[model samples]
Target: MRRIKKTQIAEMLLEHQLITKEQLETAIAQQKTSDKKIGQILVDLGYVEENKFLELLARQLEIPFVDLKSYTLQPDLVKLLPEFYARHFRAIVLKREGDAYLIGMADPQNLLAYDEFERILKAKINTALIREDDLLTILDAMYRRSEEISHFAESLSAELKPSDIDIFSGTQDFSSDDMPVVNLLRSIFEDAVQINASDIHIEPGEKVLRIRLRVDGVLQEQIVEEKAITQALVQRVKLMSGLNIAEKRLPQDGRFSIKVKDKFLDVRVSTMPIQYGESVVMRLLDQSADILRLNQIGMPKEIFEYYSQLLTASYGLLLIVGPTGSGKTTTLYASLNELNKAEDKIITVEDPVEYRLPRINQVQVHSQIGLTFANVLRSVLRQDPDIIMIGELRDQETMEIALRSAMTGHLVLATLHTNDTISSMTRLLDMGAEGYLVASVLRAVIAQRLVRRICMKCITDATLSPPEITWLKSLKHNEYLNVNYKHGTGCTYCHRTGYLGRIGVYELLPMVPELADALRQQDSNKFQLLAEKQPLYRPLVLAGMDLATRGITTVQEIIRMSGEI
Candidate 1:
């Protein structure tokens, strides 16, 4: 055992402020029962954070910290060592264990480096082939963790006391009515922000109120409470959102903002009268507007470039069709970012504007105030805007307005609730927009969906099973195209789900004369067939298959998204 120097121990005692002359004598007397090192003792006594202890060690030992992610172990070197030795070194062989070369390292004697490497790898390792920079990060993280632990320990050593509680609080003051509605609404929004929720739903029932948050496009139940409390909460939200708190009978809408951490979030609030009570839905928008770019939105480079060119054309309607929560807003935002210019006047009318962009005018649809999509769009056209973005063309009036706008020299971009690009025209026509108008003004319709991306860190090539191969053979494929299957192995980087980000499967319809003529004749099937015959034809199914072949998305996801190719 290494004996600690008296001078070093005294310095540590002084650093922690844990001793005086009398306390030093007491510590010396108690030393027999405490075998911990000076750093460990200081940490146990809550004098410093654990990282601080590691930093002290680093300073004393004069060694560098290392991180594992920056390390790239060579396989050839590890082949010479046994498994036990390799495991002891906290390193892994980069190549196959059986016939391939391997690389190994010695033990992780540097505590700071070891801690950071473990965090990056999410596992225990004695050695790693780290780059010079990563090694420095490891050392820094070790010192940081030590400092944090030391501070925590110090806080814990402080005395604890119980506070007295009133058994019977005043009923009048304790009631929910006593709290301001705005305060309650602030709490709800704060909670939503903390949980990274995209939407909040407040469902009013006969006897109770249900609150749920949509996180990552999935709705999750957060809480349920009494109807009275729920009503109070609703009023609170309405007040914060700037809606009519006193008027509960008629439907109302509002907008508000809340600051969470260092970010400000824009919140759109809507309330509708139901038989039981008022139901509310609030869409949360991240104020930063940090959306993935056109290429990062998951479309292939060629398809992305093709659409980019179409948007630049002087006059045409570009429709993006997809089901709700399929990332249509993100795609539209990306396109707007592409087209936005200081010289051009661009305006948008949305039911609830999801994001705020600089240099673009955004209008919110207020149905209760008789300001609808059609009404706002008609007014927007008069504003002399070069580009108009409608949230959705739901009704005949809005569809007509969108078509006319595109025909009258202004570009229109909007979303429609449709299954695919081919069906979007049918949906528009079904809404009573003329087929001729659609064919003349419609430039392109892009239908898309998001599918999970493969985990690159753990993804390994595996031979397709016989059944899988047979299934691939069943799909319709062009003679010119070859299909290959690939997938990922679950890893820590992807939360053990084998997938990280999502890729988009897009179906783009370009307006060719023959296809326009087919649409004009009400020959949608023929139009689709003729479009397929074109040399540049690539449907949604083909796009999905291409992504699957590249191992970016799974075949199952493609099949689910494109519906059996």
Candidate 2:
């Protein structure tokens, strides 16, 4: 048998049927005008799987292959080379062998990377093949550690004193394209993902740049530095979001995607010019994240059944009322999963369509181009949709359209910014909608808010205060009579915040015949009285109190979120 050489690896794989000739040809073609190895190129262009190609390379080179993603490295050995070199070479120090180090390279064919590692460490090294993405992932994770982040941030931030950071125009002296600044931006995102932040806020303060992570519905300050808003960091993020990097005068909206630890997340970025600099807020929308079902959203079992029935109705206008970030969109998507049927024609007009559901038509509302909600909804009606979901009932025109659609044999689902379910009716009337029209077509209203769930890893018996017990009684919920609720005592798994995640506290009000008749009569005062009579109608505060009794959340949240309700 002939020994396979580095140059012949692609040809051998082609001949061995591991890859098609066209795939090999494409990889070879991409090889030119590219610094990547033929093996890395092949794996990148979907011509071959990363692990499989690594196996083929290992077999040809007569060396062991390791999935660096799962491979752990000694931190001491990893520091053998500067991080800049490690990132540039896409190489890592795997382990030490007697008097030598076993170095892993994404492209072992590149002796330059091996030479750099050997020279930097000043040690004899044995090389092996590793996946490009895996090595980079391991390297990034290593640098993104809390201590490393603090040290690196401190190093770059040394020159960023109070007087150095300018507001209107910061020092553009440092080129934004620098490698270290780019890595700093990536490190911030990776750390955000690790901490399960729903959103990342990069704000420029008068003296310090503050980096905050919105976790479990609360924003916690993470990294703060005097020289936080570097021109390079701003330019790097602007480029990623596809916004005009040159034009920092106005606010911009753009989206970009990121892959952290094999999980792909889509970030919705909005940059607003602040006094110090552009305040960048990135909302991480993980497409690969779990699409929770309605039952999983934390509605009381009694209210969930009624809410599900509301979705089953053939024709009615259902409204979800809450403040921003109350998980209203999540509940709407879960309801769509239940209603999206092949036989039913469902269409939605969203300002920014968040999810893609099969068998349903979703159109984005570009108001600047005149594709407003009312206009798109009017167009959707022409599509003969059986169910219509208007992302928001913002204007009187949209409300009128939705109500008319619901009356004409269409199920209209939308969200409204209202304090409670009853207030939604008043908001519609105040928005110039006809009282009788709203009353006739309205079926049900759902109000919700999010509360942090107790971290199971650190859950301990909670001793409720006498005042808290008395407040629970005011909620009129019997579930808390003698229950020994639990609370998180703060643990690493929950970031020492006593809560790992959040769940919804919901209130569902279904339209009964009495309320419907009263609404059609244009008597909202009577309708409110009738709505309060429903046996299943529990206010959001009461539902949160029930969760408090079960140890799912805290009573303090009930007061903080739904005290007014």
Candidate 3:
């Protein structure tokens, strides 16, 4: 393909009328003072759309234009060019033709890069024009050292054979520093940390062992062909967690801490006997990760303000209600972090203390020794505490004591396993707490669920389907029908899933006189009606939909999260 000269780029744009002459003059003036390329300057200065200009340039240069958003490239081929060359030239290795390699470059006019690549790689080069942003996405995603994980897995498969099985002995000690099982496990942990995964699953199958990582609330699997290696891997994990390696008949739970790639991770392990073999799951919590402040979490403005006000109260019960893995504990911790002060004494009683706060006192629940939540909380009340945080409302006794503590002038924050704010009232009533007590000291309820955020690297315009429009209309959300929405096209950056991380969706319900009256009367229907009538009250579905309208999440995610709402 013929190359377009860099000097003629502006002239061609002028001939094609893609940019006004005044705009070109402005970009030229800015180009003199900045190190940026003229094409990038034009795009940055709003003189031309990036993809449109790149497509036209490709046509003029007689090169193919490729969209790498949903494109899959071989990892081996991508590694041919060093990371330094990939970033310096803004290029990616696409594929190999018989004697030449096809290279995608944002600036195909840079003939110097072509010459250097051909000289170093000893092959002819073919050029394809790609968007600069897409090039950046590919560069960051491709260099995550995923091939090293695959190589480690392959080595483990080759090293361990069927004769290595020793399930009866329940122990296979490896004194060698070059053990493949150890290397594979370490590589898997490093990869999981790099990808921000929450859980790792190692399962034994009839033919192979499957390894899966839970990222952004979804599971991504990797298969290991060696079934004999499962026993060794399980033993290693058991040993690290300080569990009995011989007792594989019953389920067991244990925890351990490790440093992977300079990040401290707390792993919770659970083992179960399955049909094939033992299924092991590891939940990873980054101990070194910064705790999110109240404002940093994704709370809407009005709700955040109201909840902040509740935290300032001298004494009341503030409950965070959600199911498992809905981020209830995170919200509770953030609130405590907001209220942590020298003048106020704060204490928490958790079954297993997940995080350690600097000034706040934390108690762990140990039922075997009679140190349950209720027992510990009853004792903590006599210590002249100003603020109290309970990890969970596990029983009726604990529920009643927490309410009494709130009524007796102590700010108590706790979490409940309920669907929404209103159901929490019913739960307390069902737990045998007096309705009057529940009504007197209850300040607010914060219900939350986590939804995956779209990958910003590959976000694009999206149109709502007919069914989605109908659903929104049924909810009286007609304002969203014409709004411009966005979604992510599958990309390597998000593992081809179009979502990178998770964000919280909140439903804040503050107590009012009318709602309290309904609660006291044990009338849940009346309480819900009055709560929904409040100006600041929005259900979980509405909150999630608002995020979808702003392109923070997708409509499908809102629907998926609102199954109970």
Q: How accurate is candidate 2 locally (lDDT)?
A: 0.78
Reference-based TM-score, model 1: 0.61
Taking all chains together, each candidate's TM-score versus the true structure is 0.61, 0.71, 0.81
Q: Candidate 1 at 116: error in angstroms?
A: 29
Worst 10 residues of 2 by lDDT: 169-178
lDDT tens digits, residue span 336-427, model 1: 88888998899999977888888999999989789999999989988999999999998999989889999999999999998887778778
Question: By TM-score, is 1 or 2 better?
Answer: 2
RMSD of each: 14.0, 13.7, 5.8
What local lDDT does model 3 show for residue 533? 92
Candidate 3: TM-score? Answer: 0.81
Overall lDDT per candidate, in order of appearance: 0.65, 0.78, 0.86
Clashing pairs for predicted structure model 3, backbone only: none
**Alpha carbon lDDT of residue 549, candidate 2?**
77
- For model 3, residues 1-565, the per-residue Cα lDDT tens digits are 7756667889988888989889988998998999998888999988898878888889889998988886657666888998889999999898999999999998887888988899867999998998888788777766645556666667776776566665434456666633777787898898798789999999999888889999988888877676777888888898889888888889888999999998999898999988787899999988898889999888888989999999999999999999988999889889988999999999999967888889999998989899999999989998889999999999999999999999999999999999998888898899999988888999999899999999997888887888877877877767777778888887778866888789999988888899889988999899988988988888899888899989999987887897856
Number of backbone-clashing residue pairs for each candidate, in the order shown: 32, 1, 0
Q: Native-vs-model 1 lDDT?
A: 0.65
